[model samples]
Target: MRVGIYLDDQGRSLDVVVEAARDGAKAGFASAWLTQFAGWDALTALAVVGRDAPGIELGTAVVPTYPRHPLVLASQALTVQAAVGNRLTLGIGVSHRVIVEEQFGYSFDRPVDHLREYLSVLGPLLRGESVSHRGATLTAVGAVDAPGTKPPSLLIGALGPAMLRTAGELADGTVTTWTGPATLADHIVPTITRAARAAGRPDPRVVALTFVCVTSDADARRGWVAQRFAMVGQLPSYRAVFDREGVDGPGDTVILGDEASVERQIRRLASAGVTELVALPIGSAQEQATTTDLLVGLNTRAG
Candidate 1:
């Protein structure tokens, strides 16, 4: 399985973020992903990073779909692809109700339907095809013109069965967070793979995102994670995933241990049919460095 790092660009400057991605490439990571937060735009920052960090895949662990129209997103993604030599993976999703409805002032009703319609419009546009879709929740009436750029690989942040089915049928794959190996093996992998096969598409990529910390004191690191990321377990989608995994909170899903133990858990994820693992290394600076080094070593061996 391929290994990647999730570069957190919450409060850092664009130069700092680009340097981080450059460092990730120098350290031999296969890819570097950025999440869309209240800070820097993930795709824009990646475009800049790609100019300096050649040969490394750049991705958005996800950009929320409600805020941007399909045409606009396609234009932006293809522009980034052109800027980055076609090394962009556009990961998108219908974010939680609280954020979409409360913050963005968009309806969160029938989100799976929204996702399906969104992809229906996005896929053809990314391929430079004209689209005239008029679905229940979304509509598109034009095509993007990004010369010399192919469609970047598309992934949706899908957790439930319906969303997984839609992702399989329409998108390239799914990007999941707060999900564990057992859930991937039993529920996620099979559901999406079957849907993709039934839709006559190739096997889908399963990219699992999780927190990691290489530490001798596992308990202490887990406590740090719980305190730092307590809000994650409260989000409705993540809460459902945690319940499905039979875990109590986000901390329970983190890969926290010494190097050997961490390697074993990551191997379990690979065994569970994960095509790629995007790790968000957490904890102290030393612990994060240790975790990243372990991932770099694993990536080298995989290469």
Candidate 2:
């Protein structure tokens, strides 16, 4: 399985972000991911980083689908694909109600239907075909200029069964967080693979996102991570996943331990049918660096 690293979005300058991607590539990480939020647009930063780290794959852990229409997103993704020499994996999602409705002032009703409509237009557009798609919720009438760019692989942040089915049927795969190996092997992989087989598509990719920290003080580290990432567990979709995984909260699902323990868990995830393990390292500066160094070593050793 491939290994990827998720970069922190801490208001770093563009040069700093690019330099980080360069460093990640030099360390032999297969891919580097960025998130979309208030700080920096993931795709834009990836575009800038592409010039410096052209050999490494670039992705978004996800960009929200509500604010930007699929046509618009496909346009930007294709542009980034061009910049990155066709090494873009466009991960997108219907973000939480609090962020979509309350924060962005966009309606978050019937997201499954919305995603279905959105992908219908977005997929064709990414293939360089014109779209005149009209659905109950979305209408995309034109295609953007993507003359020389190759189409990017599309992934969805699907947690629930319905979303998983949709991901298998429509997209290349799903990216997950706060989900453990047991839930993935028993539920996620099976459900999505069944849907993909039914749709006559290739086996969908399963990208597992985990917070990694090689430390003895796991309980203490969980406390710190909970302080930073606990709100994610409150999101309805994430809560459902946590419940299904038999976990009390997001902290329980994190991958934290010493070097050997962490490596064993990563192998278990691969055995659980994960195509990629995207590690989001967390902890103090020294711990984070150590975790990253181990991951960089894993990229070479595991390969």
List per-prediction Cα lDDT, in the order shown.
Answer: 0.93, 0.89
lDDT of 1: 0.93
RMSD of 1: 0.9
TM-score of 1: 0.98
Q: How well does candidate 1 score on lDDT at residue 99?
A: 96
TM per candidate comes to: 0.98, 0.96
Residue 294 of model 1, lDDT score: 96
- How many backbone clashes can be found in candidate 2? 0
Candidate 1 residue lDDT tens string, 157-212: 99999999999999999999889898999999999999999999999999999999
The weakest ten consecutive residues by lDDT in model 1 span 220-229
**Candidate 2 residue 271 C-alpha distance from true site, Å:** 0.8
Clashing pairs in 2: none
Model 2 lDDT at residue 99: 92
Tens digits of lDDT, candidate 2, 1-303: 888888776867878888888988888899999888888889998999889996899889899999998878988999999888999999999989999988889888889999989988999899999989877999999988887888899999998889999999999999988898999999999999999999999999998888999998999988887777878888899888888889878888888899899988888998999998889888888988898888888777767
Backbone clash pairs for candidate 1 read none
State in Å the error of residue 158, model 2. 0.4
